[model samples]
Target chain A: MKTIGLYKYLPIEHKESLLDLETDRPIPTRKDLLVEVKAISINPVDVKVRSPKENVEPSPKILGWDASGTVVEVGEDCKLFKLGDEVFYSGSITRQGTYSEYHLVDERIVGHKPKRITHAEAAALPLTTITAWEALFERLRINSDDVEGNKEKTILIIGGAGGVGSIAIQLAKWAGLNVVATASREESVAWVRKLGADEVINHYQSFTEQLTNLQIQEVDYILCLNHTEQHWESMGDVIRPQGKICSIVETEEPLNLNVLKNKSVTFVWEFMFTRSMYQTEDMIEQHLLLNNVSGLIDKGVLRSTMNQKLSPINASNLKKAHALVETGRTIGKVVLESF
Target chain B: MKTIGLYKYLPIEHKESLLDLETDRPIPTRKDLLVEVKAISINPVDVKVRSPKENVEPSPKILGWDASGTVVEVGEDCKLFKLGDEVFYSGSITRQGTYSEYHLVDERIVGHKPKRITHAEAAALPLTTITAWEALFERLRINSDDVEGNKEKTILIIGGAGGVGSIAIQLAKWAGLNVVATASREESVAWVRKLGADEVINHYQSFTEQLTNLQIQEVDYILCLNHTEQHWESMGDVIRPQGKICSIVETEEPLNLNVLKNKSVTFVWEFMFTRSMYQTEDMIEQHLLLNNVSGLIDKGVLRSTMNQKLSPINASNLKKAHALVETGRTIGKVVLESF
Candidate 1:
């Protein structure tokens, strides 16, 4: 089977950073679904993982997490998915990822793809949707079922035009929260507004002054998809007492948890890979969230966040997608189709 | 009226650290409950507030929080309690505190005194119970109502023999969680064991080794009443994926929040004064918890944590109580009565 694999971690500018290879197809094992990959999406994690590192791999390493494909085979222990099931998943970080013609993934983390969207569009949804869903519903404990009660509440999304933020804005709005999103660029501001953000602020400006100008005192929740270290104090200043803050970005420095003490605020980190990495008992939650997102998409409540699409999933197309995402200001996701 | 007041923050050994003074009695207004103080408890907050500072107060500052007294008067807006009602509360830190013969507290922060206990016993409870209850059920989001479900979960309470930890052990046990508490002394270990801790370990020893020996891998919840900086790494090491940790003790250094990122653990600060200090919309939740605690005490489901009693509340006994608490080995709360 053909695969896009890396022999060494290198900058995208280098010729050998990503390469085309012919590796033996992965076989379905216990609870594994052998996905015949159709489409894949590039995220920040893919860039971070493929960035420069000193050590070189003895064997080729695959590094795509978000994919939409058809399950050609399933392990005997798999009860959730069957053969020829069209599915979407952000596969586990610890396992061999999805940058191959055939990939093995735990069926418990795969969800039936949305019938309303194409495979490329579906590929764009899994990673961002799962991240937004878990960060808001699981980590921040936002009661999506209690829309009426949440109507009076608000959430501030930092970096609202990015992959996770694009979905998070819509989810927060769907959950009946007034969405306050931050975007430094005019295009990004317009993009988040299109994604259901009620208000957009410039991230480069003081969040305090911006919120004051908007006649907003404080937010009940904050979902940060940007540099947490840069926004830590600002988020602390604007987060309401007893509020919650969830961040996906890891900080280079230690945070003064004291700033959150007086307000009794809760700070949680959301890494979508946690469940799969830890193989937690609740790993099936990802499958459930993806299914719900698929349903929501099919129902026309949510739209695919695919901003750009490339055809013929090869090393060059994958490289192009990676380059677009690496710009760090892409409005949404960049997906590649047809390996 | 008479009060124990301090004009300067001084060492406990100072001659004028805490002094008895005559002052005009305060009147009740706007949900204020003018309580005729009967008993008061000294907590670590008292010692910290009275700790030496460079700045001196222009007027004597009265410092006490936990108290059980009879409501001599209630403001017109106060419907929770009326005149002559026996009540207990951890009064707000912003207001003049509970060290006076006549003290004013918001009726919303006060609760009906336990029917089964004396004023001194009840006095020992309000602060610690509120802190423990909020930390567990609210911050940790432990469903105390779901005892059957909670039976499968466990909590590791650092400093579980201290005032807050004493009540936390009992509450966690009542909620059907397996409670593992930490204590170094023989007497404290015995005290926490009596309070229904499923197991006890020395805080000075390695928590990892001890838990491994006990056949416990990781805990679902961690209530930290000891040094958070000292235990931060160990707590991070043992917290189950998606677990919750609440700490009352402030850390001297910035915490590396990234350590808990992979596990997706939650870190919440539980300051009992948060609601009162912020005058949050949920300030009344404290009142509700206290009333529920009162009911629990009356029904024998919970007990007061008073360990020592000093009569004729004055500078000498108060100073001695402060000295004892400063030693940081006291097993339970200390109550002083009869001003």
Candidate 2:
């Protein structure tokens, strides 16, 4: 099997940052599905994991998360998936990832790919969609079934042009929330609005002022996709009493949680890999959510976030994708297809 | 009306710390209830409000939260209680407080006094009970009806001998969760166990070790009634993946929130006054919960936490209660009856 891996942490521009390597195909075990990778997408996690760090690895480490694949083989104990079944998932962070010709994933976390979507489009949807879905519905505890209750509520999505935000806007709107998204550039602003943001504001400016100009007092929820520390105080100020705020971005500095004391607000972090990393009992929820997302996409209620695609899964294309994500300005997802 | 108030934040031992003063009786308006306070309880909030600060007030500020009284007057819109109805409540933080002979409170936050309990006992309950109830059921999202489900789960209550902890132990037990309470002193341990904690451990030691010794791996919920910053890392270690945590204690320093990332654990602050402070639509929920709590107490499902009582609510007894609370080691709650 051909795989893309890194032996050492280095900048994406470096020659050895990610390289093509030959590896033996792994056999399926209990609840495992041997998947033949068809398409893979690059995300911020890939960049963070491959960034410069001490302690070199003994073996080449695989570093992709989003993939649309086919089950080549299924373990005897697997109850959800069968051989030749098309699937899509953001593989577990603690194990080998999906940037390879073949990969193994637990059947519980894998979902059937949308029948109407292409492999590249399906691949781009899994990681970001799962993240946005779990962040809004699970972590934030938004009542997805209560459209009437949600109509009066509002959600602020930071970094609206990013992959997760593209889907988050649609999901929040689907749940009947007023969506306020932040975008710094003209194209990004238009992109987020097109994706169903009720209002789009510049992230570089004061969020409070933008909200005030729009005649909105405070948001009921905030999903921060970028620079949590930079927007911490502003989020604290603009969140309603008893409101919830969730962020996927990790902070470099400690957060002053006291700002939310008077309001009794809730702060939660959504790391998409938490269930898989901890082998939680509810890991199957990802499978359920992904399948639902697939159904919604097929039903035209949601759309894939795939914006750029490259030919053939290889080290050079993977490096290009990583470089584009490293710029921190790419809108939607960049994927590679066909090994 | 006679009142006990402080013109400046001073040491509890100071003669002028909590002064005896005469103030005009306030009239009830809107949803206000002019209650003649019969009994008042001292909570940590009283100590916090009376703590030394740099600023001096133009007028003496009253500083009590928990009170049991008879409604002497009802506002035009107040339909919950009539004149001479005995009620207990943890009044709003923004109000004039219960240290006075006559105090005004919102009808929504008040509950009918338990017929089975004395005024002092009822006074000891409202503040702590409200905090614990909101922290467990609302913030932690514990299902009150899922007794069988809760039987398999565990909740670790930090500071189990404190006012909120005393009520939290009883409420957690009522919910059918195995309650692991942290208490240092022998008497405090006995007190928590008597309050229905399934097990007792010292908060000063490693909580993980205590749980491991008891053959427990992690807790499903954590209600932190004490210092959040001190026990944060320990709470992170013991919280199960996808578990929920709620706290009433304010952190003095910035918290390292990344500790809960791997488990996707939720941390929420439960300030009982939040709904009333914001005049939230769900403010009626407080009235409902308190009425339910009153029923539980009358049915002998929950017990009052008043361990000490003083007669005739005045400057001297309030000063004594303040001094005891300032020690930071008071068990249960202390109440003062009548004026």
Given candidate 2, what's the lDDT at residue B136? 90
Model 1: which residue pairs collide? none
Across B1-339, the per-residue lDDT of candidate 2 in tens digits comes to 999998999998889888999999999999999999999999988988888898898987988999998999999999999999999999899888899999999999999999999999999999899999999998899998999999999999999999999999999899999999999999999999899999998999999999999999999999998889999999999999888889888899998888888787888989988988889889988888999999999999999999999988999988888889988899999999988
Cα lDDT for residue B111, candidate 1: 92
How high is the TM-score of chain B in model 2? 0.99
Q: Which regions in candidate 1 have their CA more than 4 angstroms from the true location? A: none
Can you give the lDDT of residue A22 in candidate 1? 97
Q: What share of the true interface contacts does each candidate keep?
A: 0.83, 0.77
lDDT of 2 by residue, A1-339 (tens): 999998999888999999999998999999999999999999999999999887688988999999998999988899998878999999899998898899999989899999999999999988899899999999999989999999999999999999999999999999999999999998899899899999999888998999999999999999999999899999999999999999998888888888888788888888889988888888999999999999998999998899999989999999999999999999999999999
- Sort candidate 1 into its docking category: high
Looking at model 2 chain B, report the run of 10 residues with the lowest lDDT sum: B258-267
Supply candidate 1's per-residue lDDT for B301: 97
Q: Assess candidate 1 and give its TM-score to the true structure.
A: 0.99
Model 2, residue B93: C-alpha shift (Å)? 1.1
